[model samples]
Target: MTGAWKKFSAQAGITMSEPVVEQMFGGERDPQRVADERRWFAHEMRASTYWQPDAAVLRAATPRIVVGIGGDSAGQLCDRTSRALAQSLGTEPTTFPGGHTGFVEIPDVFATHLRTVICEG
Candidate 1:
């Protein structure tokens, strides 16, 4: 799973430092933590497999839709998907600080930006 994380980070253009990797794994000595992370990944995979978005509902609510892409996530999966969604909605995505994990990495800045976006609407 750690290798999977590394591969995913690489594919996503995210450079994970040793400390960050360690933090993700909950320290080198914690096998349970690693297992927990693997379970989480599995759960996400399962959820994604079964999840489907209703295009009609999304189109109907386009005016209230606020597609946000991370500033540093250019060309990444989330960025591409967000752009596509915004395009389909006849709108543009708003850029936020950092990448996909921006909210977790820069909570304060992300929250502030989110608030501003919401207020502007």
Candidate 2:
């Protein structure tokens, strides 16, 4: 997944590869945390394969606002998914700077954008 993450980060317009890698594999002494992460990953995989939500119920429960990653994330799968989700939610995804790790990679800008969105709602 290292190569994949690198590709993702590149598309995200961020380059904290060392920190990302360390965060992913650094907990050598924390067996419990590792085990928990494993369980969560398994659960996520299973859920992704089987989970489906009712659209009407989802629409009723969902907020109408959406913000999507801009810049280098263009043409990426995550961007496409974000657009699709916004469409399903009956709104367009507003573009913000950075990508998947934008909150971490560009915290000040991302936080400002987030505040603007939240305040608008």
Winning model by lDDT: 1
lDDT of every predicted structure (CA atoms) = 0.80, 0.66
TM-score for each of the candidates: 0.75, 0.61
Residues 1-121 of candidate 1: C-alpha lDDT, one tens digit per residue? 6677877778666787977876774345567776776886777755864565776689797478888999988988678778987887788899999888799889999999999999999
- Lowest summed-lDDT stretch of 10 residues in model 1? 21-30
In the order shown, the candidates' Cα RMSDs to the true structure are: 2.9, 4.6
The superposed Cα distance between candidate 1 and the true structure at residue 55, in angstroms, equals 2.2
Clashes of 1: 0
Cα displacement (angstroms), candidate 1, residue 83, comes to 1.2
Give the Cα-based TM-score of candidate 1 against the true structure. 0.75
Off by over 4 Å in 1: 17-23, 26-33, 46-52
Model 2 CA lDDT for position 110: 88
